[model samples]
Target: MTTRNIVHLDADRVYWTTEVTYDRFPARQLWALAAPIHELVIPARLRHAAGASRPGDLQHQLVTTFQRRLGNPVLSRLPGQTLLETTGRSSGLPRQTPIGGRRVGQEFWLVSEFGERSQYVRNIQADPRVRLRLHGRWLRGVAHLLPDDDARARLKSLPRLNSTAVQAFGTDLLTIRIDLD
Candidate 1:
C-alpha cells in the first residue's frame, strides 16, 4: 500500500479500536482527515447525481430508499427532529412528513426539495393550517409557501448537514415559512 493510504488506515484503526477520546489531539487529527477522505472516495458523478441537468434515476433510487426505509423511521424517533403535519388534499386526512428546518423567533423555515410538485407542498396549498413537532413538542402553525424567496441563501442559514443534503439532492427548491402559534 502507499504510505499515505497506510497512514490513513492506521489512523482509522487507532481511532476506532482504541479508547482514545475525540477531544485528544490524535483523535482530532484523524477527524480532520475524514473530510478529505470522504470527498476523495465519492466520485464527482455520484456526488452531483441529483443536479437539474442530470437524469434523476440514481437520485430517485437513493431518495426513495431513504424516505421509505430510513429517513421516516429515524426522524419520527428523534427528539429534536421536525415533523410537519398537513391535511391531505385528496383524502382530507392528516398527512405527516418528517422534515428539516430552523426556527427563528416564532417562525419555522424549511425548503421543499421538489418545490410545488412535492406532495406535502400540495397539501399545504390545499390548507395552510399545519402542525409541527419541534423539540418533542407539537405546536400549531400557518404554512406559507415562498416561491420568491432565495432558496440557496435560505439553505445556507439552516443546519449544515441537512442543508448539504438538501442542496445536493434538491432539484427544484421552494421555501416554506411557518408562523408558529
Candidate 2:
C-alpha cells in the first residue's frame, strides 16, 4: 500500500495525515470522503472565524484568518481534489479512495462525477468518515466528518467526467473537477 500525506486547515489549527494505498485506489472514492467535509466545514469555519476577537472567539478567528490568508495555499498543496488510497479492512487490504474535485476561488468549491463505478466512489457511499490533512509553511489542519446531508448535495453537483489534457506524458485526461486550491 502506498502512503500519501495530506494536510488540512480548519477554524482552529492545521493537521497532517496520510492516505495509505493511494496508487492502487481509485479517484472517485477519495472525493466522496473529502467533498462533504470540505463543503460544510470550510465555509462554516471561515464564517465562524471572521468575527472572532476575544478568547472565546480565538477558535473562530483562527479558522477565519487561516481561510482568508492561507486557504488557497493549503489547498494547492493537496495532491488533487480526488485521491486514491489503501486501507486495512477485514478482507486483507481494502482500498480507501476519496473523490471530490476542488476549485479554489474566493472560497474553495468541490466537485465530483457521481455514479461512476470506482473504489473511491463506493467508499463514500458505504462510509463517509474520512480524514484530511493540510501542510503549510508553518501550520496544518486535520478534518473529518460524521456524515451529513450537505455533503451529499455537494457530491451530486460535481461535474461530469470529460475532457482531455495533453502533457509531457502524452494525451491523458479523465472526468475531473477544476479546483484553484
Candidate 3:
C-alpha cells in the first residue's frame, strides 16, 4: 500500500489531499489491521507537532472514544467482565461502564483511568449511589472517589490487564471504593 499527500496551492486557495493505493488482497488485509493504529497515531502526532498543550489528552480522547463507542458496549454485554452502572449526570439515564475491580467482603474496589474526567466518574461525583453488576448479579452500592489514595499501588491490586492499560493511558488516576449492599 502507498499513501500520497498532494498539495495544490493557488493565490486564493490551498488544496490538501490524501491518496491511498493498495493491491487486491494482501495489501488490503495489511491496511485493515493498520488503519486503526494509523488513525490514532497520525492525529496525535500532528497535535503534538503543532505544540498542543496536552498530548496525553489526544490519547485519552482516542481511548475513551474506543471504550465508549465500541469496547464498553461489547464488554458490558459479556458476563465475564465487571460492569459498573452509574446514573448519567446530565441525561439522568443509566450508564453502564465495563470495569476491572475486585470484591472483598462488602466492598468493591477499582481505579478510574481518567479520574473525574471519565463520564461515570463524573456521574459518581454528582451521585455517589450506583449499581454494580458482579458475577451476573446487580448489587447496589455507594461509590467513593479517593483522590488521596495511591492509585498506582491500588492498580497493583486490580486485574493485571486493566491495570496495565490504566497505568499506560491514564492521565489522572484515581482510586474508587464502593460499599456494596
- The TM-score leader among the candidates is 3
Better of 1 and 2 by lDDT: 1
- What do the candidate models score in CA lDDT, each in turn? 0.77, 0.38, 0.87
* Between candidates 1 and 2, the TM-score winner: 1
**Model 1 weakest lDDT span, ten residues long:** 1-10
Candidate 3 lDDT, 1-181, residue by residue in tens: 7878776878855455567799567888898777776667766765576576474677787899788778988998798778999999999999898999889899999999998889999999999999999998899999999999999999998889999988998999999999997
Ten consecutive residues with minimal summed lDDT in candidate 3?
46-55
**Local distance difference test, candidate 1:** 0.77
TM-score of each: 0.66, 0.24, 0.78
lDDT by residue for model 1 (51-140), tens: 423455446445745676668888778777789999999999998888988999999999987788678999999999999999889999
Off by over 4 Å in 3: 6-17
lDDT (Cα) of model 3:
0.87
Question: Candidate 2 at 133: error in angstroms?
Answer: 4.5
RMSD of each: 11.4, 21.9, 3.4
> Which candidate has the top score in lDDT?
3
Between candidates 2 and 3, which one is better according to TM-score?
3
